[model samples]
Target: MAVTLKAEKREDLNKSVTKQIRESGYVPSVVYGKDKESKTISVNSIELVKTVRDEGINAIMSLDIEGEQPVNVMLYDYQKDPLRDELLHADFYMVNMAEEMDVEVPLHLEGEAQGAKDGGVLQQPLYQLQVRSKPADIPEAITVDVTKLEIGDTITVADLPEAAEYEFLDTEDTTIATVVPPDTVSETDEASDEDAEPELVGADGKDEE
Candidate 1:
């Protein structure tokens, strides 16, 4: 599904100009492509948030710039205020639907890890995977099943479900999720004495007598 947004060209290119635009409830943005000339634009803050919430960043967008024809684009990047969660700026990458592109798709874990039930710790070391596929064919997310995972077991990139349309960009050995024993003090920790002096060696390569 295509997410569409309405925007108007922004002529002023200054910090004060962008600040004023935000005060007026708009997000300053830039759209650029391999062949298309870069253009400065702005979109209504409320509408932009709604579009992102519904379609996500991977979805193809139909940017309807005022006084120009609509163009296809992808949400490349954006910034937000850390304290207030206000949208600051955005950059849209124009793309050709037929061309393949590399992107990171979120990994969604499903089911409970058997290790967790046995008092083991379940860890998700990686939250997303990089994949190459056509912009239009990009998936919303890749789901992983963890019901069979046991303690000390791990799921690697190579274990992911086969997707003929996607080429995973990560090394096959990279672990996405794993289960391990709960943290506990080791024997070495219990035996160590903080007051014990460290061993010293003589300059002649022998232990001190």
Candidate 2:
């Protein structure tokens, strides 16, 4: 389900004005579509945070603008306070529900790998997958089960299950996760091997002076 948020048109576009808006407890934002001009607006900070937390970045949202019909949008970009982690600003991309759009959706790895349980290290190189799908059909996330994976085993983009509504944009060969054997030698062991001296002996099998 698409989350709904209320917004009011904003006239101020300066940095100072935005800063003041943030101080007043509203998140300044912009909405733009390929067919329409961008418009600035503001939403309640508390409401915006809740909506994002509940819907995530992949889901479509309905923005109810004052005096206008609600528009469908997706979270496109955002900024945060470096020290406070507060949301500074956000940009919502107006989307056509019937048209396909490309987006990056998070990949969730589920279940413990058998190799990892047996002392092999598990690594995940890709945390998200790029895909193209209609706004209404976008998935919140993709799950990859690693329970059966063994040491040296890998799961790639090609291994993902087929979703009829989605067209994966990532190359099929991209690796998603893997398990590998643990190291057998320590730095101390390597140094000892390098420093050990060979035994010096005479031709008659006696130790040389």
Candidate 3:
């Protein structure tokens, strides 16, 4: 869900002044991105938190700043007050809805794995992969079926049900998740001896314990 916010100008950029601003119940934030200059504005802390908590990190927000046209942006990062547990600051990234957006969507696996019932371990190597699509076409998450996965059966990135219009940012050969025997040997052996071991141990003797 997209959100909208109204911001006010702040003349003070000093720490002491910004601290005073926070104490009064306002959150100072900035919107940063590729082409546009960074702009600083203050918003209602309670309202800002409510919008973010209700929506999501990827939610596009229409920011209404004085003397400037309303700009739509996505929340990229934020800083919080650990002690007070309050919103300290936030950063919004400018999003171009018309262009393809690369995002990582959540992964949800359904049903009990047949292999898992017979002492097979279901390992989800990668829960999410970076995908490219327009904002309106963005999917909340990808669903994977584990019901038919039997021992020794492997699932690769290509097995995922990808929308025709979207492009997966990951390589086609990338492994997503898999169900295998409890022994955990075939994949482990191939990954370790052939490719993974050398990369995992650059010089350190960090073999499997």
Candidate 4:
């Protein structure tokens, strides 16, 4: 499901104009494509964020323009205010139904890792990956099972599930996540770790003395 938002034409194009627009509760944005020329537009920051909140950032959108043609696009760049955490701007890229489009889908790790059961730390490196597939066949998130992953176990890019239309753009060497074993504590290690004795030498600070 897509959240539909209402937008109006924005005539301002400069930085000052954009700041003013954002102050007025609007997010400045643009829509462009290989087939058409670039367009400047704006949306309500609150509504726009809400529309993309439930769905992932890469979720497909149906943009409803007032009088112009309805456009199908995916949310691209969304700029935010670092200090205030405000939505400042957005960008949309046109989607073609005929061609295979490359997109990044969020990876969702499922199940407690077996390594974790053994007091090992589970680390997931890749957050999202670029996959080529049709818009309709695109998935919101890719799920990876981590139950069998033990210490030193790695799930590479090749380990991901396969879909007929999707193609991975990353190298096979890319590591998605892994588990590391916890270091064992020993009596000797604890004694040596905390106690340090300083050797005194006559008029010199040297072990040779």
By TM-score, how accurate is candidate 3?
0.74
How far is 17's C-alpha from truth in model 1 (Å)?
2.6
Predictions in order: lDDT: 0.86, 0.87, 0.77, 0.80
Which residue pairs in model 4 clash with each other? none
Off by over 4 Å in 1: 184-209
Q: What is the lDDT of residue 72 in candidate 2?
A: 90
Pairs clashing within candidate 1: none
Q: Report the lDDT tens digits of candidate 3 across residue range 16-75.
A: 988888989988888767788888888889878888677655567888788878877877
Off by over 4 Å in 4: 14-16, 184-209
Candidate 4, which ten residues in sequence have the lowest lDDT sum? Answer: 200-209
Angstrom error at residue 161, model 4: 2.0
Over the full model, what C-alpha lDDT does candidate 4 score relative to the true structure? 0.80
RMSD of each: 11.2, 14.7, 7.1, 11.5
Residue-wise lDDT of candidate 4 within 124-185, one digit each (tens)? 88999888888767777888999999888999998876778788888988999898766532
Please list the residue runs of candidate 2 whose C-alpha ends up more than 4 Å from where it truly belongs after superposition. 184-209
Candidate 1 global lDDT: 0.86
Q: Tell me which residue pairs clash in candidate 3.
A: none
Expressed as tens digits, the lDDT of each residue in 1-209 for candidate 2 is: 67888998999788888888889989889999997999999888888888878887776889999999999998898877766767788899999988999999999999999999999888888999998999988888889999999998999999888989998999999999998777632554688899999966764432211
lDDT of 1 by residue, 1-209 (tens): 57778999999988898889999999999999997899999989999888877776688989999999999998898888766778888899999988999999988889999998998777888998999999888888889999999998999999987788888999999999898887632333455665567877664432211
Better of 2 and 4 by TM-score: 2
Winner of 2 and 3 under TM-score = 2
